[model samples]
Structures are given as C-alpha cells and as structure tokens.
Target: MSRQTSQKIAFALLTAAAVVVVVPIVLVIIYITIQGIGAINWEFLTAMPRNGMREGGILPAIVGTVVLTFGTAIVSIPLAIGAAIYLAEYARDTWLTRLIRLAIINLAGIPSVVYGLFGLGFFVLFLHLGTSLIAGSLTLGLMTLPIVISTAEEAIISVPQSFRVVSISLGGTRWQTIRHQVLPQALPGILTGIILGLERAAGETAPILFTVAAFYLPRLPRSPFDQSMALPYHLYVISTQVPGMSTEVQYGTALVLLALVLSMNVVAAILRSRFRRKRRW
Candidate 1:
C-alpha cells in the first residue's frame, strides 16, 4: 500500500475503535435517563427515604457525597500540587524522582478494597474516628492522592517549556517564573485533575464502606466527624441491600450520581476552554 493510503486506513480503524467505545457510553446515558428521568423530583431530592425506597429521596447521601468530595479536595489538592511542583519544577529527573513516580503509580494500582482495609485499621481503629465523615474523607483523600499527583504533575509539565525559557532569559527567578507565568497557564489543567480526583473520591465505595458506613442517617452532618450515608453507599443499599426496593429509586439514585460526576466533568471542560482561549489571546 502507498504511504498515504496506509495512513488513511489506520485513521479509519482508529475512528471505528473510537466509535465502538463511545457507543456503549451513549447507550448507557440514554438507558439511565429513560429509567430515572421521572424519578427526579423535589420530594425525592429533599425528603428522607421511606416506604422501602418508594417515598424517600437521597438527601443524607447527597450531603455526605458532597462533603466527602469537598473535604477530600481540601485535604488532597494542596499536598498533591506541592508534591507535583517539587517534582516537576525543582527536583532532578533522577532516581529519587523516578522512585516517587513509581510509588505513586503503584499506589493508584492498589485495590480499593485494600484501601478500605487500611482505612478500617487506621482511621476506624487507631484514630478512633469510627464510621465518620472525616474518616471517609481521609480515606478518600488517600485514594485520590496518586491521581492528583500524576495529573497535576502532567499539567505542570505540559506548560510550554518555551514560557519557562523566556522567563529565565528575562532574568526571572525560577520560583517567580513558575508562580507568575507557568502556573497560571497550567491552572485549568490542574483544576481539571483536581475535579476528577474529587469525583473519583466521591464515587469511591470500598474505603468508605469500612470507615464511614452509616445506616439511614436521617439528618445531615453538622461536622466532619459526624457519621453519614454517602451516595455510593446509598446506591448500593437501594440497588442491592434494601429489601423490597423499587427499581425507580435505585435508577434515580444512579442517575443523580451520574449527573453529579458529569457536572464536574463539564465544569472542567469549560475551564479548559477558557484556558485555551486565553492562550490564543
């Protein structure tokens, strides 16, 4: 085959592969919307769940999910970014950096159930937090640490080297150059990673199942140490644990959680767009 023809054939196969992957996702969204759209209601959202899932909403779970997400973000983002900054902007790309990167990747590869076990031992037993929101948040933060570090570092490294070189040529200090020029440009990507990390933390179940499991927390949490029902747990209870569960409520919880994750993703996309626009300017 001619080179151009070969290239065209490869592109065609890649496009087909993309479509194959995307088709299932599109179908899932459609199926979820159809199953859960009618269940989206103010009462369902605000009221306590009752009637074996036919009358209540997911208020406590929703609140817990949000708290866990935000709390995880608060705890993990700064530490991840600081680590990323040190690795990308300061440290030599030597054995030490390689070891750290490897360790981060390995952490991400560790099973969620193992994380749950660790959380149970440390946060629940050692820390004496019991099944509390703070315990869950700390576990979730640990869960997302690798994601935040790897992604934040990629974002930092993605900032054009030309920008750094120019700053250096202009006699800007390394720290000042990064602070004033490189970081702003990289901010959107970093934010995207942060949001994704939070989302991952929010959807987590295993680690949270051990450290933050709450049975029907009718009232919302007043503090981080308070125990609560998280969204993933709510879904599991509705879909799997609860007796005489209505399909509608189960599907509804799934849809709402899906929407929550998609909202985070959409916001990240908007931020990415604005960043690209600024780059053009």
Candidate 2:
C-alpha cells in the first residue's frame, strides 16, 4: 500500500479505538445522571440518612470520604515523595534498589481486597487501631504509595541533569539543590500522581470496608479513632445489603461518588496545566 493510504488506515484505526474507549464512559455518565438527578437536592446532600438509610441524605458518608481522603493524602504524599527522591537521586543501581523497585511494582499489582485484608491484620488488629478513620487512612496510604512513588520517581528523573549540575557547581548541597531546583519542576507531576491516588482512595470500598466503613452510621465521626460511613461502602450496603432500598437513593449515591472523583480530577488537571505553563525550561 502507498504510505498515504497506510497513514489514513492508521488514523482511522486510532479514531475507532478512541470511540471504543470513550463511548462506554459517556454512556455510563448519561445513565447515572438520568437515574440519579431526581434524587439529588439540597436536603439529600446536607442531611443525615434516616430510617435505615431509606430516607434523608448521605452527609456523614460524604464527610467521612472527604476526611479519609485527606488523611490518606497527608500520610502518603510525604512518604511517597521521600521514597521517590531516594530512589531517583540517591540510590545507586544495586541489588537493594532493584529489590525495592520490584517490591513497589508488586505492591501496585496487589488487589484492593488484599490491601483490605492486610490493613485488617496490621493496622486494625496488630496495631490495635480498631477499624477507625486512622487505620483506614493508613491502609489506603500504603495502597496508594506505589502509585505515588512510581510517578514521582519518573517525574524527578525527568528533570534535566543540567539543573542539578548548575546547583551543585554553585556550592549548593544535594538537599538544597533538590529542594530549590528539582522539586519545583517536578511538583506538577507529583501532584498528578497524588491526585490519582486520592481519587482511588476516595472511591475504594474494600480497603475501607475492613478498616473504617460503617454500615449505617449517620452521625459524623468526632475523631480519627471513630468509625464512619463512607460513600463507596454506603452505596454498596444500600444497593445490595439493604432490603427494599430505593433505586433513586442508590443511583444518587453513585452519582455523588462519580461527581466527587471527577471534581478532584478537574482540580488536578487545572493545577497541572498551570504548572506546565509556568515551566521555564
């Protein structure tokens, strides 16, 4: 075939692949919106669930998800960034480094349910955290660490070596050079990973199911030690476990969860764009 004809065929195939990926996503959003929009109102968002979650809203679940996600971020981001920096900048290629990378890769592939089991064992029972916000947050932090570390390592490694060389030539210490020059350039990519991790943590049912999720708690958690309702768990319970549950409520909960994740992604996209625009090199 002529090169132009081959190029046209490739373009057509690519467009078909894009449509195949996007159509399902669009259909899901449309279906959820149609099913859930009627149930979403001011009261549904702000009020506590009543009557075995058949009435009222999911305020506690929403609050719990937010708190849990924030806690996960707090616990995960610094550790991930530190590990990434060590791996990318300090750790020489050796057996130990290779082992660590292999471990991270393995962690990333582990099932979410397995993380839940590990959290139950280590954080809940062994540590005596007792299935609370703190235990759940720590579990999710661990679950997300691999993602953050891998993304951050790549981001840091992508920074041009000349920047580090210049900083070192000017008498800057290794830490100073990384803190002043490298980190700023890599922040956007690190944030991208963090955003993705947080989004996953927010929507995850399994990890929190064993660690923090309450079946019917309507009141807000007063402390990190307290058990609380989470959106994913709540949706799961109402949709499957609860008898005679309203379909509207189920769809509404799903819609809310979808919206929450999408909003986080939008914010991350905006930040990434702004940082990209600010890049000087």
Q: How accurate is candidate 2 locally (lDDT)?
A: 0.95
Give all TM-scores, in the order shown: 0.94, 0.97
* Most accurate candidate by lDDT: 2
- Tens digits of per-residue lDDT, candidate 2, 186-221, equal 989899899989999999999999999999988999
Segments in model 2 whose C-alpha atoms lie over 4 Å from true places: none
Total backbone collisions, model 1: 1
Against the hidden true structure, what lDDT does model 1 obtain? 0.86
Which residue pairs collide, candidate 1?
49-56
Residues 74-96, model 1: lDDT tens digits:
88988999998998899997998
Q: TM-score for model 1?
A: 0.94
